[model samples]
Target chain A: MTSKSTSPRRRQQPPIALVILAVAGIAVFIVPLIGLLARTPWRDLPALLTSDVVVDALRISFIASIGATAISAVLGVPLAWLLARVEFPGRSIVRGLVVLPLVLPPVVGGAALLFALGRRGIIGGPLHQMTGLVLPFSIWGVVIAATFVAMPFLVITVEGALRNLDPRFEGAAATLGAGRWTVLRRVTLPMIGPSLAAGLALAWARALGEFGATITFAGNLQGRTQTLPLAVFVALETDRGAAVALSLIMVVISLTVLIVLRERWWRPL
Target chain B: MNPLAGLDAHLVVSRGDEFTLDIRLRVPRGKTVALLGPNGAGKSTVVAALAGLLPLEQGHIALDGRTLDDPDDGVLVPAEERGVGVVFQDYVLFPHLTVVDNVAFGLRSRNVKRGPSTAEAKRWLERFGIADLAGRKPGDLSGGQAQRVALARALITDPDLLLLDEPLAALDATTRVDLRRTLTDHLAQFSGPRMVITHDPTEAFLLADEIHVIENGAITQVGTPDDIRLRPRTPYIADLAGSNLFIGTAHEGTVTVGDHQISVADRHIDGPVLAAVNPRAIVISLAEPGGSSRNSWNTRVERIEHYGDRVRLQTGAPLPLTAEITPAALDDLRIAEGSPVWVSIKATEISVERD
Candidate 1:
């Protein structure tokens, strides 16, 4: 019989078992990161880093990711607000569909993007016929592809934040002589600023690392369409060291920005 | 400017098989009324309807002589155009904006540019004694500070009707009591109609000139605080009535119950009447012979609950009664559950009314 007076002894795991479990998780993630750092050619690193192709890929990645982020904010934030606040028919279905990209493979998402925005696509055909512009293998196409894949990240983040916010704040804004558009611009947007930043960061990361959709739709060119991820993928076929080095740069940039973001804004209330 | 200065609402709301707010009330300019109710008494519904957040099922809402909502006339003012300020239950402060920015939000919406809006916000913050904390976000402030900011933001636009929905329920007891006076001062300074919803009688009494008690979705009584606290009709009302009331048959000068003839303070044509007595009014003694109090009975103590300064004795005789006594009296008499004691009350202490 167990009594309240006597202290309970903790069950211990075997040293071997603990070591094995830790090794499994580490080998999948930490080991690969260590491999990248170790395999980096310190002698050829400077020459490879100074290359114009690498510089252009980095520039394209930054510009496209930022463009995707801004576009997502303009479109996705409102969509998120609508999803959270509006009470219309098929709302539950719309919410489920908004999070659909998160569970899907990026490559399959690229293929679906191709079918929709291809020359003969429903709306794409009209645009191509009227304006003599086919978006395939273009920088703008890369942005569209990255946006389609990354926007859901922003939408989901903002939607969750909006759902948690009390609806009364909107009412308070309305009573203060604010119209619908004004409440969205002044009150609702500022209130969810942190969630918006978090959403932007995630979307930027997703857009920057986009290899499948960009290559599939925009067809990884030398400088125009080739982002850092596409450059790394192309380099993998020729020089493995160069591929690792490109990935390391992307990793360093993302990790540094993420650290800064967390320090400035994600503190516990 | 919004023309909702004096809101007169003939409100009708029904949900499911029960609950309705089919009552009419008018809030005059420059006065405060409290909506007091239990948990699900549709108190918030009234505020929501007035604010135009919830579409009313029926009735007419006219503010400042302009119709806001009239289902019969197809008149409904949009929530954005209603111009009825609200301080929500959770404070609902914009988590991202600083105190100044959150306050400025209202003025900014009124087409006053940023420079003027923030100046007005700063002025309001100074009035609330929170100008020093104006740069800080809502997440940085304490509960009391946040609530003041919410009130300030709601009032900054000088709205016609201000609705506060359980604004102090989120506060600690000490802070709640202290904030009541500050809120009262603010309400007095404002010249618009105000409605405050609260479940606490103490809060309602402190803030409201007129009190409306809602029970099971209907306005059961609307009166002064004294009236609601003393002359409660329903059980929910009696719960707030402070004094304990019991219904019993009156025979001659005595009332028969559980094999005992109990004397009543009430006289003249009496079949049944509710005996009202304050728990503090009854005196408990150890002696069985009782006293010259005119109404005394041999009672068996059922239970004893110790309050901070006093003890409530729930005793059983012909009728079960609860009496509040000081701890010293309880200690001296050694009062405990199942003890045989004599309970006495002055005839003047008891008041009887028809049930």
Candidate 2:
């Protein structure tokens, strides 16, 4: 009865907005969402969704982003562990380098990926000469570009989680006759499981939205290398209505993934 | 069977220029040895060195006729392979694992597969009376429950040596006393040589068959609990062993200090010396002690602290002296600080040694 009586008063709360502008300081973010929703074309949405180019780009985008996120967890986690745990000369420089891609413009990262993995590039030349293989303008190039740009998010997140964990747990595992690998697998990873999940989600989201690097490296090929963002970019140049429909689909998929993630893995539905 | 036969270690670990631990310690098989020291006296360093967690610049460690660490000879086993179990100051239970899984961890690491190792973990959890909490994580356990889980975790492997680093320091006073006896009984039944480091004398005396008083990274004194109580070498050890320590002089059978010539027993020096006598040895009376008493002094009472069955009376006289007496004695004499009292000790009770 007391709670019921308090509900109306809660609904009639005062306008304390400008009185406290600190919380409302980030209101600029909502303008984009408002603009996106308003400009998204509702008519001809079904025809746009049924387009063969749209379907193939969507499939490639999902596959490449998920693969990049998987690769990030495998390689980035151990590197994060090393950055967090071990001490050596140039450690600070190595840690700084891990976050380089976070600040590097996506197009610059694409150029960097091309120089390193292009057909005549350092390790790329030997691979091309020996196996007649190259990563440039291919589905694999999209993965490389996404991984390059998205790995910093996974590494930094997992590293922060590792730093916050009480190191005594690892010591306890050591005294229990477990070696370093066993301790990492059984104790350290499980202890940071929440952070791992959160980091993977963030990295996957970042990869899914990758455009500059994927287009520069993979050349927006339909059904082969083009991702959803690339498809949306091409549609924006040619057909504005179709561009809005593709963008709405991207928004829906991202929103659904985020909502499901929050409900299932994060907040425990 | 003796799990460890006479573990001997001479460990030297230096952190900074000022912090150094160079001490040798020994624990016989199936005996509980207490490493008694004050805070920051390198007791934990000794434990860490023995557990092989810290590297020693100069040391030789042998357990049960096996060479575990000897830096001079280049033989050092890391902590995991040394087969030494440790209960750290904070218990160090894995917060992500269940109580049972934490206990079963050691067995599983030794390649004893899941079902049997978990059965062993269950038995240990039952032994510590925490079987119902087996499925719960370490974060869900209370202090006492976590301590028991840590104990079960440390003991499941049945390591060669069991080292406890201030196991009860984290608990409340009441929990400490209760757990002290429980831990003591469990340790008494432990087959391996056990070592515990603590600053509490009562804890040391209760759990230790023999006690070693450590000061400034060296073993200052080593003896049974009674021996330490009777003759403590340093001020901290003296206070811990319930003895009043003072600096005085002895010539023949008389000690002179501050214009007071007190008669004592078996004196060889006429200059400065360390004089220690048990607080329980001094008797307090309402008047001057009668004739034939070797030493008697009129002193003003300073302070008093109740220690379980005994009352520790601090007094200022010819020397700062602490006396131990029964509560009954306290009531009979009406002992209070600022009250003039007569303190007398037999010549034989006072033990004097050159510092």
Best by DockQ: 1
Question: What docking grade applies to model 1?
Answer: medium
Q: Worst ten-residue run, lDDT, model 2 chain A? A: A1-10
**DockQ by candidate, in order:** 0.61, 0.60
What TM-score does prediction 2 earn?
0.79
Name the regions of candidate 2 deviating beyond 4 angstroms: A1-26, A261-269, B1-4, B239-355
Kindly list the per-residue Cα lDDT of model 1 for residues B1-355, writing each as its tens digit. 3445587888898877766778778788887888898988888788889888887889888878888888888888887787788898878887778889888878888789899999989999999999999999999998899989989998898888888888789898668857877888887867888888999876787688888888887788989876665455455665565565555677666655446555666567377655668888888899854446777878799877665676777778566776778899999999688999988878668766543
**lDDT, model 2, position B116:** 100
Worst 10 residues of 1 chain A by lDDT: A260-269
Which residue pairs of candidate 1 clash? none
lDDT of 2 at B281: 89
Q: How high is the DockQ of candidate 2?
A: 0.60
Model 2: per-residue Cα lDDT over A126-226, one tens digit each: 88999998897888898988998888989998998899888877877887888989989998998888788878888999999998888777778888888
> What are the per-model C-alpha RMSD values against the true structure?
11.1, 11.4
